[model samples]
Target: MGVTYRRILLKLSGEALMGELSYGVDPAVVHGIAEEVAELVNEGIEVAIVVGGGNIFRGMMGAAAGMERATADYIGMIATVMNAMTLQDALERIGIPTRVQTAIAMQEVAEPYIRRRAIRHLEKGRVVVFGAGSGNPFFTTDTTASLRAAEINAEVLFKATKVDGVYDSDPKKNPDAKRFKSLTYSHVLQQDLKVMDSTAIALCKDNDIPIIVFDLSVRGNIKRAVAGESIGTIVGGFCEVC
Candidate 1:
């Protein structure tokens, strides 16, 4: 069968790297994810990733205290850089050609946010990792994911979540929370599903990009999503039928 989704933007939460361990990057877990993604690359899928920094720092969390908004956001951005570097090392360690592009300017370390260059890397079969949350203090990585997905003209936005799919309620708190196999963008907004930040959902909706929420914690989920297996809740023009 032909490979599905020629280009995809995979949004990975830093917390997913924990892998049942402490709150940090787990080598085994990162390597496993990299290998899975590498398999998809082998199948000719162009992948670009936007990694969240929640595992290291969340500006809003500290902002609840007396932390300055700008300061806290800068810290959060740095945390994303760290996660990006870690993921870059992991992916490259496994022989997958990779590039780390940052929103913030860091010429000595990584390349600045160059949309053309990032797209070129993907076209040349390199995994591009986007870091620093849009290079702005107020915007979140979720928004950044949507923005970059559109910029790159990706076929879909693969949102890597802890759960397998979007549920009517918090699946962690309510075991009986019904899982949705798929969903339309209007349904996600109408039902008030917390699949993504409102800003993120709005951006994707306005741009007509599909957002696929799936459990990245499960092995091979990334590849499966890229291969268009309908493994998770897809939000866009189509509705998720029961």
Candidate 2:
């Protein structure tokens, strides 16, 4: 089968790494994800990843509880580094050459974020895992994913979340909630559908990067998405999901 996106950026929430655990990364879950990613690599798809930090710490939660916002965000960025390292380890264990690049500059552990170098890595078929949420206090990992996808010239962005797709209401709370098979970025922003933050959605809208929102819990879903299968909601594109 032909690959739909030759180069794509995957946005993995820290919560996605939690799996059945209440907190932190799950080795089995991560390994399974790596194996699936390896299949994409075998199919000649270039992958870059941007991981979130909510599983360990959320900056907004700290800010809500009286901590300084910037400090809390910095701590949250560090949490993403830990998650990225864990993912890198899993990918490498399975023979996928991976690099963890942090925006905040922890040179001893990982490489500093350099746009050209990142693109070169992708061109060489190495999976580049981006961490630290754009090295800014206010930006979310969603925005980071958009930014990186644009920088790397990625054709699409895959948002792997706990939910299968963007729903009209909370799926868990409301079983009658309808899942959107496809969405436009403008509609997502205007309707406040929560596919991503407004900033994230706006960036993709401006750059023309399609964001695929899918459930990470489903096995082999990553490869399916790469093969252009309709396993989730496709934002900024047309085509109903099966």
User: Which candidate has the top score in TM-score?
Assistant: 2
RMSD of 2: 1.9
Best by the lDDT measure: 2
**Per-residue alpha-carbon lDDT of model 2 for 30-128, expressed as tens digits?**
998899888888778999999999999999999999999999999999999999999999999989999999999999999999999999998888999
* Reference-based lDDT, each prediction: 0.88, 0.92
TM agreement with the true structure for every prediction: 0.96, 0.97
Candidate 2 residue 233 Cα shift, in angstroms, is 0.5
lDDT digits (tens) for residues 1-242 of candidate 1: 35678999999887888888768888898898889888978878899999999898889987888899888988999899899999899889888899999989988889998999999999999999998889889788889999999999998999998899889999889989988877887788887898888889999999999999999878878877876797878888457552
Candidate 1: segments with Cα more than 4 A from true spot? 240-242
> What lDDT does model 1 reach?
0.88
Counting clashing residue pairs in each candidate, in order, gives: 1, 0
Q: What's the lDDT for candidate 2?
A: 0.92
- Model 2: lowest-lDDT 10 consecutive positions: 233-242
